[model samples]
Every structure is written in C-alpha cells, then in structure tokens.
Target: MSHSPVHPQLRLYFENPVGRLLEHPDGYLVVQYNAGKRKLEELKTFLTQASTLLQQRNWHKLLGDQRVMAAFTEAERVWITENWLTRSTTAHPYYGAVLLAHDVFARLAMNLVMNEARESGLVYRLFEDENAAVAWLLQVP
Candidate 1:
C-alpha cells in the first residue's frame, strides 16, 4: 500500500496490502480498505490485526471506510460474520460505522455480513459519507 498519510487525527496502527488500521484520537478504530480483489487469508489477517488492536485498546467503536473496496467473496463474508465479528463483540459493546462503496455488489455483500454482526450484538450503521460516519460513532458511548 502507498505510504501516504491518512486523516490528520488518525494514528496509523497497522497496514497491509488489503487495508490499513488506524486509531482515532477519540478512542475509536478506523479501517480503510484498498480497492482490489484480495485473498481470504489476506482479509483474515487484516481483520485479525484490527481485532487485536481493539482488544488491546479496549475500544468499542470502529469506522470502516470501504469506499473503494471490491466485493467480498462468499467465504470472506461468512468469516467476517461468524469469526471476526463474533469474537470482536465478546470483548466489548462494539459499534461500527461503515461508509459504503459505490459498487452495489460490495454493498450487498457487506450488508449480509453486517446483518449477522448486528445479530451478534454489534450496533452498526451504513453511511455514504466519512464525516457522517465519524460523527455518529462519536455520539455512541
């Protein structure tokens, strides 16, 4: 991934080819995905790193910027729902605000995963704008 800096307020935590994990000054996590097809292992590694950071920080809020992301494979979606989301929520009262991509297929795939995440006790919302997503996350305790 390019070493370009992210938002001034976000501290870069971890990054790989698939995505970058960042920490907000307001005690939230940020995950911004790259635009490309990725392997399941890559996705898992990326999310696992984010989960580790969340556990370490005891942070419950996540801002997922998926604006340029491609569609997730069925297996990838299942893993997110069944493995990552479930485990992550066990550590805190997790809340996520995701900025949806313009790609309809990506949005549909994420909707499926997030539906399961919600059932697993995650409070989350989808957004079209980053500022709106961050604003909402800041309001959640």
Candidate 2:
C-alpha cells in the first residue's frame, strides 16, 4: 500500500485492495473503496475500519466510491446494509454519496441501498463522477 498526504489533515492510501480515507475539513469522513472482489471476512474488516473512522471523527458525511467493486457476495451485501447503511442513517450524516462508475451490478445494488438509507432519515445521493459527488457533499451545509 502506498499512502500520500493529500493535505495536512487528509491522507490517501492506495493498495491492491484499494481504499482511501479522507478526513474532510468539515469533520466528515470520506471512504473511497476501489477494492475488487473479496471474501466475507475481508469485507467485514474493511467495514469495521470504516465504522471506527466514522465514530472517531463523528463524521456526518460519507462518500463511498464503489467504481471498482465488481460484485459482492450475499453476506457482503447484508453487512453493508445492516452495519454501514443502517448506522449512517442513525448517525444522520449530513450527506452520503455512493459513486458508481463502471459496475452496473454494484450500481443497481447501491441504488437500492440508498433508497433504504433515505427511508431511515439519511440523505443520500448517487453519482458517476467524482466532481459531482464532492460538489454535492460540499453544498450540503
């Protein structure tokens, strides 16, 4: 894994199971997952780390870029919905962006997940471009 300090407070890490955590200026956290397929255990570990970051930072915004996640197992899907999505709803992150670039399957799944998240009182937006995602996140005061 290679990490580069994008900003004084923001660090970007890159790896085969690529993921980057951005400590946003407004106390929100952005996690961009570019990891390919992985086992349930791996997914759990990833989500656990993300959960910890969110809790520690008291993040009110989440940006998940699943552009490279080709597919997810049933368990992985369940974990996301039960843990990350559900928790984000209760946490009431100012805004959550799920970015999907190429994977149609993941995009579809995220759409459903976003809908469920909205029902839970969390605001979510789906986008295919990074610029748009960031713009939306920044606009939400």
Candidate 3:
C-alpha cells in the first residue's frame, strides 16, 4: 500500500484490490488499503487476518493504517461491532492505534469505529503517524 492513496473516480477491482494485511517486524499487524474504497468483503478479509494472527500470537495490539483506505458504510461498522469484535480472538485487542487518512470522511469513519467499539469494550486511539501510534501501544493503559 502506498503511504498516501487518492483517486478521481474511486474505482474498485475485486480480483486484486489495493488492500493489504502485513505483519510488521516489530511484532504487530499493520492493515492497509493502498487504493480505492473498501467494500464489506475487503474489510472482513482484513479483520479475519487480524483474528487469525491474534489466535496464533495472542497479541492485543495492532496498527490499522487507513491512510489509503476509504470511508466505510454504516452497516460495515455495525458488522465489526457485532460479529468481528465478539469472535475475533481469544485475547482481543484492548489497545488499538490507528493511522488515519487526511480525508475527513475517512477520519469520521474511523471515529465511528472507535466510538461504537466502546460498546463492545474495545478502545482505539487515532494517530497521524506511525511513531505516535507505536508509542501509544507501548504505554500502559
């Protein structure tokens, strides 16, 4: 995924979307959408990756970089709170640091995720850069 993602038409290609789920050498997962908007399937795929990693490694920290990601639909947000959060991992993430895009729509989308997730007992903080995100992850809550 590119550090920044932008497009005029926002066309999506299903066979090879710009989304990526990668593990950082620092021992955390970093999920990114390098281009176009994220549909429900893409979002679920990423969440599945996180769940699988957590099941194996049991880490409760992850960096969700949505700088290149697009805004999410309301139903998508609800899906996360309902299904993903409930069945994600044995050691569900309590502290999440997110890197958001400069776009207001994307920022608001993330805000909704973080806020509504509180109802499910997940707390995530937004960050403009990776350094601050990792720093917050290291700090004890």
Best by lDDT: 1
List the lowest-lDDT window of 10 residues for candidate 1.
1-10
Local accuracy of candidate 1 as per-residue lDDT tens digits, 1-141? 533346788788988889899998999998989999998999999999998998899899998888889999999988888888779657457999998987899999988887788788888899987789889999998
- The clash count of every prediction, one per candidate, is 0, 1, 0
Q: List the residue pairs that clash in candidate 1.
A: none
Candidate 1 has an lDDT of 0.87
> Which model is ahead, 1 or 2, in terms of TM-score?
1
Q: Rate the local accuracy (lDDT) of all candidates.
A: 0.87, 0.67, 0.68
1 against 3, candidate with superior lDDT = 1
Pairs that clash in candidate 2: 60-93
lDDT of 2 by residue, 25-131 (tens): 76566676654667677667766777777777666777776777666666777777787776665545447777774777877777776667766667888887778
Local lDDT at 108 for model 2: 72
The superposed Cα distance between candidate 3 and the true structure at residue 122, in angstroms, equals 1.5
Off by over 4 Å in 2: 1-9, 12-18
Overall local distance difference test of candidate 3: 0.68
- Which digits, one per residue and each the tens of the lDDT, describe model 3 over residues 11-101? 2222236465565555665666665766788677767766777567666777777776777778787888788777743444466788887
